[model samples]
Target: MLTTAEILRKVRALEIKSKKLTTDLFTGEYHSAFKGRGMSFKEVREYSAGDDIRFIDWNVSARFGHPFSKVFEEERELTVMLLVDVSASSLFGTIIASKKDIATEIAAVIAFSAVNNHDKIGVIFYSDKIEKYIPPKKGKQHALFIVRELLSVQSGQKKTQLNTALRFFNNTTRQKSIAFILSDFIDTGYQDALRVAGNKHDIIGIKIYDKMDRTLPKLGLLRVEDAETGEQKWVDSESKLVRYEYEKDFFRITDYSNEVFRKAGCDLLHVRTDEDYVKILQRFFISRNK
Candidate 1:
């Protein structure tokens, strides 16, 4: 647990980092990437020479016997939901930062971007079970509160169940939203839920990983521990066969995940802990806008 002073300090640091990121990278890209619901009808206006004939208001035109056009306003407000994985696997990292830290930082950047664009942001923290849910809201204070929670919230357990989180999100949010699921994706058997959620929401998955996850270091014999299960085992990392098998497993898992995302019609972005996340995010936003 963090003391009050410690929490305050962390909050301040995250605010500075997230605010700078939002301003520098996402200001324009985020605004143009996603759109709200369909436009709403506004007051009619006199038809211009080049106005579309399909939008002509027959009632108003007939009343005055002059061409009039129906005007519509774009719905500017949007809802952005961050589905964060707080499972124990997020604690692992062989790079500059842990998976949890990367997830938290990315979540903060997206949340700040959403608020800057006058959109509501929400979060659903899960670890096999739902830990906490902060409903959709707008403003800097809300974004800061979410960052605080990301840094401090404790899960009741330390396991991964992506299906549970997706089911909960599907049940809770009735309207369509833009949702970002940030996780290491160590678990399986969530394809159906993912498909369902993707059908309703604009869903994107950000897969956080470390270099060591793909290949084992030539450290001879080493004891490995599973973060989620707390299981331990000794592995001969120096052996060629062991390293080959490890790389094969890594590729298999990644390929399966990619196929699932493709079938669900959801976008997936992979980010390593030691890499620059800002560039990854900027590319994603630009692609989304395109």
Candidate 2:
């Protein structure tokens, strides 16, 4: 656990970094990447040559004896929800920063971007269950509160269950929202819930990982403990077959995660702890815009 001063310092550092990324790379892309719910009827006006004939107001046209068309405008206000995973697995990182650190930074950047665009921002922090839920709200203060919570949330239970979080989100939020799930994605069996949530909302997954997650170095025999379960085991890292199996499991998980996101019609982005997440996010936003 981090001390209050330490948490504050981390929050301040993340705020500075995320603010720069939000302003430089994600400002415009974030605005264009998400769209409003639907068009709203504005008013009826005399039909013009370029106006679509499908939108012609037949009753008004008949009454006025002239062609009239209904004008519609895109709803500008949007709601963005960040579904963050606070599972113990996020604490493991062999790179410069931990997976949790990367997730927190990215979440802060995204919240700032949404608020900057005049959209409401909300968050759901989960670890095997719904740990916290901050209702969607506008303004910088609200976004800051979320950032603070992200940095300081301590879970009594460390296990991960993505389905529970998705179910909670699906039930609580009725309106369409731009939802971002930030996690290391070590849990499974959430495909059905994910698909259901994706069908209702614009869902995006940011999978945070570390270089060591893909390939473990041969460090002789080491005792490892599961972050969530607290189970301990000893493994020989010198054996080639052991290393190969470890790598194969990592790839298997990665491939399955990608396929699940694709099948649900959602976008999946991979961000390593040592990589530039700002660039990765910018590219994702541009791709989504396209």
Which candidate should be chosen as best, given lDDT against the real structure? 1
User: What's the TM-score of each model vs. the native?
Assistant: 0.90, 0.93
* Cα-based lDDT at residue 170, candidate 2: 99
* lDDT value, residue 174 of candidate 2: 93
lDDT of 2 by residue, 148-173 (tens): 99999977778999899999999999
lDDT of 1: 0.90
Can you give the lDDT of residue 58 in candidate 2? 100
Write the residue-wise lDDT of candidate 1 on 116-165 in tens digits: 98899999999999999999999999999999999887776889999999
Worst 10 residues of 1 by lDDT: 31-40
| lDDT by candidate, in order shown | 0.90, 0.90
Q: Poorest 10 consecutive residues of model 2 by lDDT?
A: 31-40
Off by over 4 Å in 2: 48-67
lDDT accuracy of residue 93 in candidate 2: 89
